[model samples]
Target: MSRTIDERIVEMRFDNRQFEQNVQTSLSTLDKLKRGLDLDNAAKSLDGLGDAAKRCDMSVLGKSVETVQAKFSAFQVVAMTTLSNITNSAVNTGKRLVSALTIDPIKTGFQEYETQIGAVQTILANTQHEGTNLQQVNRALDELNTYADKTIYNFTEMTRNIGTFTAAGVNLRTSVDSIKGIANLAAISGSTSQQASTAMYQLSQALAAGKVSLMDWNSVVNAGMGGKVFQDALVRTSELLGTGAQNAINMYGSFRESLTRGEWLTTEVLTETLKQFAGAYSEADLIQQGFSEAQARDIAQMAKTAEDAATKVKTFTQLWDTLKESAQSGWTTTWEILVGDFEEAKEVLTEVSDAIGGVISETSQARNELLSGGLSSGWKQLLDQGIADEGGFIESIQEVARESGDAFDKLVADSESFSDALKQGLTDGVVSSETLTQAVHNLREKMTGMSQEERKAAGYTAEMIEQIEALDKGLQNGSVSMEEFTEKILRPSGRENLIQAVWNAAKGLVSVITPIKDAFREIFPPATADQLYSLTE
Candidate 1:
C-alpha cells in the first residue's frame, strides 16, 4: 500500500485512515457487548421484584380472612343475646296475657253480665211469642220469686205449679195468680208450697169436671175461693191438733180424693175428726204427731165442742176471710192480697222506687227529665184526683201511686226511649253548656248546705270536694261551663293516658313486626298472628 514519497504519504494516510476505521469499528463492538450485559441485569432485577410482589399479596389476603372470622364471631354473640332477650320477653308477655284473659275477676263479671243479657233477651222473645206483655210477665216472675223466697221454695217449683194449672185449661194469668195464692197459703199452713200447689191443681181439675162446686161446705168454697179451697182446707187442717203436719198432709190427700170422687166435705168434719182422735192421744203423743207442746197441751185438755177446739189454735182463716172481706169492701182484684199488709207494700214500694230511680238517673236526658218532670206531674195529678170510693185515703193514694208507677215503668221500658240514637241525642242535650251549668248550680247549692262531715259521709273524697269547689268557682267566674269544667277534670289522665300510650306503642310495634313476620311466615310454619294480635289489643 506504501508508494514513493508522495505515494508513500498517501499510502500511509490511507493506512492511518484504515487503522482508525478499524479502531472505531472495534470500539463500537465493545459498546454493543456492554449494552447487552446491562439489559440482562435489568431483566434479573425485574424477575426478583415480581416474586416479592407475589409474597406481599399472599400476606394481605391471609390478614383479611382472619379479620372476617373475628367479626363473624362477635356478630354471633350479639345476635344470640338479642334473640334470647326477645324470646324471654315474648314468653313472659304471653303468660301474662293468658292469665289476664282467662282468670281475671273481670272475666267472670263479663260472663255473668252476658248471661244476664241473654236471659233478658230470651225472656223478651218468649213474652212476644206467648202473646203477653213484658211488664206483666216480669211482674208475675217477680211475684213468684218473691213469694218463693219468702216461703223457702224454689221459684222453679212455683213455675211448675203454674204449668200444671195451665195444663188443666187455666189461663196463664190465672195460673200465675193461683200459684201465688197457693204459695201464700203454704206460708200460713207450714207446708211446702209444692204440696199446696199440687192440692190446688187437683182441686182445679175437680172443679173443671163438676166433681166440686164453688158453693160447697157452708159456702167456704165460694166463687172468690173456687180453686183455692184445697189449699185453704190444708191450711186449716195443719193448725188442728192430732192432725199436725204429717197427718194434715195425709188428710189433704184424703180430701183431694174425696173431691175427685164428687164428695164435698165440710170444714167442720176436719175439726171433728181431729178432736175425736186427739181426745185419746196424750200431749207427748200429739207432740210426736207434729203438734207444738202448747198445741198438744191444749188438745190434751179436750174442749167440749169443735168451736172450743178451734179457738185454741190461732185461725189464719179469719185473717184470710178478713182479707177476702176487704176485697169485697172495695179492694178487689189481685191488689186485694196487699190489703192489711202495709209492711209488705212498703217493701215493694222501696224496691220499685230504688230500681226505677236508678234507671231514671242514668245519663239520658229524656229519662232524667221524664223522671223529674213528667213522672212528678203525673203523680201530682193522680194525688189531686184521688178515688174517694176505692178503699180509704191510704188505699186511694196507693192505687194512684201504683198507676203512676206502672205508667212510669212502661215509659222507661219503651224500646224507643232507650234506643242508642235517642240516648246519644239525650246525652248531648244534657251535656249542653246551659243545662250542665244549671245542673251544677243546683248540685252546688245542695252541697253548700251540707257540712264537710256530710260531704265525706256522702262518699265525697277530699280531692273530689276540692274539684267541686273549683268547678263552682269556674262556673261563677264565667271561665267555663260546669260541663266543660267537669269534662276537663274527668278527661283521661294519669294511669288511663299511660295505658293508652302503651297500647298505641304496642300497636305500632305490631304493625312494624307484621311485615317481617309475614316474610318469615313464607319461609317457616305459620303462627297464630290473629290470637297474638288480639292479645296485644
Candidate 2:
C-alpha cells in the first residue's frame, strides 16, 4: 500500500484505504445500477477529511495543500510589496499637501486641501488592508470599498458646499475639456485649443468605443466610508474656504475679491478628490490585472483541453449518427439487422460510454485522494490543491465540460477541417476515439432487439470489451497515447491526436501513459500486444 507515517495523522479514524475504497465502491454501485448520487454532500465530507489531514500535518496530503498555500504566499508577498510602494507614495504626497494646508502663510490653501485629506486617508486605509493573496486581497478590497464609499461621499458633500463655486468647477472642467478637444483635432496632441479639442473628441471617441455604461454619480453620501469621507471633506473644505476667505477679507478689507479664491478652492477640492478616486481605482485595477495575468495561462490551457474534448464528444455523436444512417441503407438492410449484423456493436458502444464514465469517476476519486487535506474537498479540493499549475488537460476539459454539452459541438465542427486535411491518415484511417466509442454504444442499442442467436450471427462479441480494457490499460501504463492507440484500433485519427496532444501538453506531468504493446497484450495476448504496436508503428 506504500503506507506512510504521514497518512496516520488525524487519521481518518475510519480505515483510510477501506473508507475511500468503500465510498468509491458505493459511488460506482450507485452510478452503475442506481445512478447519480448527489455528490455535493459526499464532496463536502471529503473536504472535511482534507481539513483533518492538514491539521494533523499528514505529509502526503499536507504536502499538496502546503504547496498551493506556498504559491499563494509567494503571490501575496509580491502584492504586499506593491501595496507598500503605493502606500508610501500616497502617504508622502498626502503629508506634503497637509503641510501646505498648515503652512500656507496666507492660510488660503487649507480649505481646498481639507476636501482632499479624506481621499488620502481613504486610500491609506485601503492600502493598509490589502494582502498579497487572492482571498486576502479580495477581503481587503471589500474593506477598501467600504472606506472608498465614505471617501467619495466626503468629496460629494464638499462638491455641494463648493457647488456655490460652479464657476470654479466650470473653469477646471473647461481646462481639461479644452486640452482634450485640441488634442482630438490635432489627431493626438498640440499647442492649440482647437487641436486639443480634436484630442478631446478622440479621447471621447475612444471612451465611447469601449461602450461604457454610467452609474449614477449621486450615489455618494448615502452609505459607507465614501459617504463619511465626502461628508468630512464637504464640511472641512467649505469651512476652510469660507473661514479663510472671511478672515482674508476682514483682514485685507476686500470682501468681494475673496470670493474668486474662495471659489477656486472648490476647483481644487474637485480636482484633488477626483485624483484620489482614480488612484483607488488604479490601485485595485493594478492588483486585479496582475492576478488575471497570473491566472490566465492556466485558464487558457484548460480552455484548450476543453475545446479538444468537446470535438471528440462531437465526433462520437456524429459517427453514431452516421452509423445510424448506414444501418438504414443497402449494406445493412434494416436498423435492427444492421445492429445484429455488427455482432456485439450494441454492447461495444454501451461499454464505451460506460468506460468513459468510469474514467471520469476514477479521476475524480484520484483527485480527491491527492487533495485529501484542506477546506476544499473532492473536485474542489483537487482543483484548488494543485501544487503544479498544470492540472491534467482531462481535468480541465472535464471541468469545462461540466459546464455545458454545447461547447463540444463547436469543437467537433471545427475539427472537420483538420479531419479533412488528414482524411486518410487521421480522419478516415485513424477514426475519432469518441466516435468509435459512441458507435459501439449505438451499435449496442441498435442491436438490443435482436435475439442471442441473431447477435452471434451478426458478428457481435464480448471480445471488443476485452480489447478496450486492454487499450485502456496500455494508455494507463505509459505504453501508448490515446492518439497512437486510437490510430491503431480506429481510423480517422484527428480527434484522438488532438485530444492526446492537448492532454499531454496541458497536463505537463500528470498523465499516466501506457506502452502500446503491453496495453494490447493486456486485452489480447503478449503476441497481439507486439502486433498492435508494430501495426501502429
Candidate 3:
C-alpha cells in the first residue's frame, strides 16, 4: 500500500490543488449570491472559508465550513421571504415601485404590486384550468383596474395634501382615521378631491393647535357640519374663547342639536348665542362670588354686548378690580373702627385681605355687608346701643360678616324685644341719642300698656310668642353664637342691654292696651277714654 515517499507527496499536491479550485468555485458562487441579495456578512464568512481552505489546515477549514453553513442558511431564509413577498402581491411593477418609493400605500391601489401576467396566472392557478374564460376574466380585471385607478388617484391626491401638512411638523396620525373619514365624506358630499383634502388639512391644523379636540372634530364632521361651516365654527370659537374653544363640541351641544333639528340654519346664530351664553354663565359665577346680583347681570350683559374675547376679559378684570378695591376699602374701614390701628389688626386685616382677594381671584362671595352701609352707620348702630367694648364691637362685625342665609330667620325670632328696648332706652336716654334712638322711642310708645293675653286676643299670634321665647332661651343658654345674637338680634332690633329688654316688654304691653282702647273708640264713635280703657280691660 506504501508507494515511494515522492509518489505520496505528488498525490497530496494533486488533492490540495483540487480543494483550492473547489474553494474558489464556492467563493465565486457566494459572491454572485451576495450581488443578488442583501447578504454582506454571509459573503464575508464564505470569503474567510476560502482563505482557510487555501491554508490547507483541516481544523481551521472545518470551523470555517460550519460558520459559512449557518450563515448561508439564515441568508437563504431571508432571501426567500423577501422574494415571496415581492412576487405574491397582485399589483403591477410600476405601482409597486410607487408604493415602495413613496412609502405611501394610498399612492397605489396595492401595498405591494405585481404584473397583469402574474394576476392571470393567479386566476388560472386558482381555477386549476387554462384558456377557458380568459377573455371574460381579462375584461373583469380591466373594469376593476379602472375603478381602482380612479380611487387611487383621489386617495393619492388626498394623502399628498395631508403630507403637505405633516411636512410642517404636524402629527396627522393622532386623528388619521378620522381625517380619512372626513376626507371620504367630503368627497361623497360633492366636494372635489382637492377641496376635501383642504378641509381635512384645516381640521388637522385645528386639532394640532388645540383649537379643537379629536372628539369635537369628529362630532362636527359626524353632524355633517363640514366644508367651510365646520372650519368657520372652529376658527370663530377659538378666536372667541381662546383655549376654551377646545371644548367647543360640549359648549355647542344645543347648537349642534339645533342643527340636527334644522332649527339653526347658520353658524352666525350659533356663535352669537354661544357668546351670550358664555357671558351669562360668567355673570352667574360672579354673582355667587359676592358681586351684587345687579352688578353680575350687568357684567354679563357687557360681555355679550362686547362680543369680543379680549373685551370681555378686560371688562371682567376691571369689574373684579373695582370689587376688590371696594372690599379692601370697606374691610379697612371696619378694621380701623374695630381695632383702632392697622398694626394691631394685622391678623384680622390679613383675614380681611384674604377674604377680599379670594372673592376677586376665586370669585367667592364678597361678604361685604359689614362695610356696605358704611363704617359710620355700623358704628352708630352698635355705639348707640352702648356696646363700648372692643370685643363687643368685633363680635358685632363678625355677626354681620356671616352669610345672610340664616340672618333674617334669627332676626325675626329675636326682633320684638330688642326693637321695644331700643325704642324706650333711646327715649329715656338710657341708650345714645342717635337718630336710631328716636325711631326706637316712637316704635316703643306705639306698643305701650298691653297684657300678654290681651295682646293675644288682639291678634298677636301664638307663633310670635313661641319665637320670642325661643330667642330668649337661645340667648340665655348661649345656644346662639354671639355674632348671630349681635348682628341678627341686637343690632337689627336696636336692643343694647337687658334694661332695654324690660323696657321693651313694658312698652309692648302698653302698646297692646293702647291699641285696644283706640280701636274700641273707633268702633263706637266718640267714646270716652274711661269707656275705651274699660272695654280694653
Candidate 4:
C-alpha cells in the first residue's frame, strides 16, 4: 500500500490545503463569539480542534497547530477593538441623557436664561479643564439651578414695579445689584410692589415740578411721609405762594417746624401774614426815599391792603400820582406867597384850583372831601384841630403828611386788626374816613382780652371748646378737616355716654320682662314658649 515519491508529494499538498481551510472556519466562529461577549463559546470552539485532529493524519498535526495559533492571535485583536467601541458608545449615551434632563428644560423655559446657561457652560468648562470629577460638576450645577430659579422669580414678580420706576426715570435693570436693591426696598417697606411704584412716581413728579428738592424728598420719604399726606402738603404750599419754588420750600419748612412747635395757623392765615410783612417792608423803603409824604403814605396803604403784588403796585401808582400833583401845587402856592408877588400868587392859585379838581376826580369820596374847595380846606382842618404849626403853614402840611405815613407804618407793624380791616375795606370799595375810624376801633377792641370763664359765661359751650381744640390740633398736624375732628374726638366722647345709657336701658328692660317670661314658661312647654315668642315677633 505504500505510494511512490511523486504521489506522496501530491497527497501532502492536499493535507496542507485542508488544514488552512479548517483554521479559517475556526477564526470566523471566534469573531462571532467575541461580538456576543461569549468568551466561553470561543474557547470551546478552539478546544473542538482536538477531535478534528484525531480524524486527520498524524503527519499534518504540526502544520495544523501552527495555522490555528496564527488565527487565534487575529481573533484577540478583533475582540479588543469591539470592546473599545462599545465603551465609547455607552459614555456618549450617558452625556446625552444628562443634557436632556437639565440643559433642555432651561433652554425651553426661559429665553433670558441664556446668560445663566453661559455661566453654567463656563463652570463646566473650568471644571473639566481642572480635571474635576462628575460629582463636583453635579454639585456646581445644582447650586446654579437654585440661583437661576430665584433670579427668574424675582424678575417676573417685579416686572410691573420696574416699568413704573423706569417711567419715573430710574433704570432698575442697569445692574444685578440695582435690581436686588429694589427687591430689598419693597420687602423692607412691607409695601406691595404697586404701592412702592406709585410712591416713587409721585415723589419724582414732585421733584420735577419743583415742589420739593431732592434732599427734601429723601428726608420726607425716609421719615415715612411718602404718600398722599406728603403730596397734599407740597401741593397746598405751591398753590398758596403762586411763585418761586424756593419760596414754597421755605414755607414748607416753616409749616412743618410750626407743627413741631404746636403752633396752629391755617394756610390762609399764614399766607396773609407773609404777604402783609413783605408789603410793609416794601412800603417802608418808599417812605425813606424822597417821595412826597402824602404820596408815600398812600403807597404804603395800598401795598398793605391789596390782595396781589400786581394790584398793590398798580393801586399805589394811581394814588401816588394824585398826591404828587397836589403836593407840587401846594409848594408852588407857598413859594408865590412868600415871594410877595401878587401876579405869581394869582397864577399859583389858578394852578392849585386845577390840581384840586384833578385830585377830586381821581380819589375816593373820603379823600376827595378832604381836598374839596382847595388846599385851604385841609389847612383849615389842621388849624381847627389845634395841631401845632411850629414851622409855618407849609411846614404844617409837611408835618401832616409825615404823620399820615407814620400812622400807616404803625398800623401794619402793630395792629393785626388794622391790616385785616384795611384788606376788607379795600376789597369792598369802602376805603373812606369811616372805614379808617372803624379799623382803629377794631384794633382797640382786639387789644382787650377775655378770660376763659368769661368766654364760657358769654355762651361758649363745652362742645364748642372741644371743636376749637380739635381744629387747632388738626391745623398743627396739617390735617385740616371738620369731619375728621367730629369722628375722631367729638363723636367718640359723646357716643360713649349714649352707648352706656342704651346698654343700661337694655339691662333694665331685660329685668322688667324676665318675670312675665318666667310666668309664661311655668304654664307652657318649651314648644309653647317658642310659639309665644313667635306671636310677639
The best candidate in terms of lDDT:
1
**Candidate 4 residues 1-537, lDDT tens each?**
356887988998998999899999999988987888888877888788877866777757787998898899888888888888898888988776566444543443342233323333433443444464445533433332332233212222223232332343332222122223322233333334344344444443432333334444454465343444233333333444353333443655744443333223332322222223224335466456444466456545543332232112234433443233233333333443453233344466678888997787767756744543233222233222222221232332223334445443343345464334333333443343333223223322322234667655655455544444443444446564323322222122333456788999999999999999999988974676778799999
Give the per-residue lDDT digits (tens) of candidate 1, residues 322-365: 33222222222233254212235456778888999877767576
Error of 3 at 90 (Å): 36
Q: Sort every candidate by TM-score, greatest first.
A: 1, 3, 4, 2
**Candidate 4 RMSD computed on C-alpha atoms after optimal superposition onto the true structure:** 40.0
Which residue pairs clash in candidate 1? none
Worst 10 residues of 4 by lDDT: 171-180
Task: List the global CA lDDT of all models.
Answer: 0.48, 0.38, 0.45, 0.42
Candidate 3 regions exceeding 4 Å error are: 1-156, 164-176, 213-537
Clashes of each: 0, 75, 15, 0
lDDT accuracy of residue 291 in candidate 3:
55
lDDT score, candidate 2: 0.38
Better of 3 and 4 by lDDT: 3
What candidate 4 gets wrong by more than 4 Å, as runs, is: 1-154, 157-183, 200-250, 253-537
TM-score of 1: 0.20
- Model 2 misses residue 397 by how many Å? 32
Q: Ranking by lDDT, best first?
A: 1, 3, 4, 2
lDDT of 3 by residue, 382-483 (tens): 343323233423333323323334443344355574444433433444433223323233323322334777665655444544443443344347563334
